[model samples]
Target: MEDQVELKRVFGDVYFRARRDQNTSIVYAHWYGSQAVETVKAGGYKFLEMIKEKPYRKLLNSNEHVIGSWDLALEWAQNEWAPQMRKAGLRYLAYVVPTTIYASMTMEMLIQRIDDEFEIRNKEADAEAWLLR
Candidate 1:
């Protein structure tokens, strides 16, 4: 499998990438970064939808997977992307990256809110294990 990681800033959302199989793409947002959290808070669903509809859509056709960084964002992602993507035969997986000690607790909280949330099988390891599968 061919993999690529790119750092991109879209509408002020600074995120990193971990792409596997070209079609299967994951956008790992920088959680502790200066602008990103604020950008998401400010942009809300509008920003997420734009990201989903444009950049994510380009990579994710039928039978592709797109992963995002935050659970709140994932909630937005599920509501915004899942139905359309599923109809097209694509799957969406949303998992949180524990960038800080605080974020690990945050992930736990978010996991409680959603049913059947995708948790990293091994929180201590890299996401590649889960993403590649």
Candidate 2:
């Protein structure tokens, strides 16, 4: 949520910026624009890379500006990303669910596949609170 970005992933004009919240020691990412299967995979890689750099147990993933469903990436996200998050010592995830129906559904699918402590919130503030708590 701060301007202290550590890394960024760009797909066209969309920007996925990640930073470590010094206040809470949580790695968080916020992005804008639409998502496809490829973008989802790429974002997953970027998230993993960021989290793996530190022993961060919590993540705040925001999809508030994301415009499309990432349903096509569900298989890879479930089979690969989920397991890797656990391997990287990630224990808690606070996902800010998008407002769109399909995008929210996609988030639900991904959340259900995760085998760790996680929460989905409609607002970033709520997500951050849950992550910090």
Candidate 3:
């Protein structure tokens, strides 16, 4: 919690928080509820911006509270967001899968589409540990 930067925006449906520990930094994004494609896109852009400015090597995206499909945003995420984040020095990604079957499935779909090295788990602690290791 030493180098924590709260990246949450007032209007956005997603909550973001960026934290750094030694050489690695993590941008944590948790979906609030059902979100629109534009909302997802906006969150991605904000995430990229933060990592670029801070240069985080790890990203933790939690979809635990998501209630609807973000499948529409998957294409942009795989094609654009992932690549851009990698270019910005993102090497590890930890995704916290949603508890609901539908949301978890959708989140997994995006994970498979991404070319980056990442791990999917049900707990944020596990994700953090993986990112650190």
Better of 1 and 2 by lDDT: 2
Ranking by lDDT: 2, 3, 1
Give all candidate RMSDs, comma-separated.
Answer: 8.3, 3.4, 3.7
lDDT of 2 by residue, 1-133 (tens): 2334533445346557787766798888886677777777777887787677776888888887778787888899888987887788787888888888888898888877764434444455677777767
**TM-score head-to-head 1 vs 2, winner:** 2
lDDT by residue (tens digit), candidate 3, 77-131? 8888888878887777787877777777888798788845444444656886887
Clashing pairs in 3: none
lDDT of 1 by residue, 13-99 (tens): 434433434355543333334323433444333324434443442221111122333445545444544444444433334454454
Clashing pairs in 2: none
lDDT of 2 at 71: 87
* Residue 36 C-alpha lDDT in model 3: 63
Best candidate, lDDT? 2
Candidate 1 residues lying further than 4 Å off, grouped into runs, are: 1-23, 33-38, 42-47, 54-99, 115-124
How far residue 91's Cα lies from its native spot in candidate 2, in Å, is 0.5
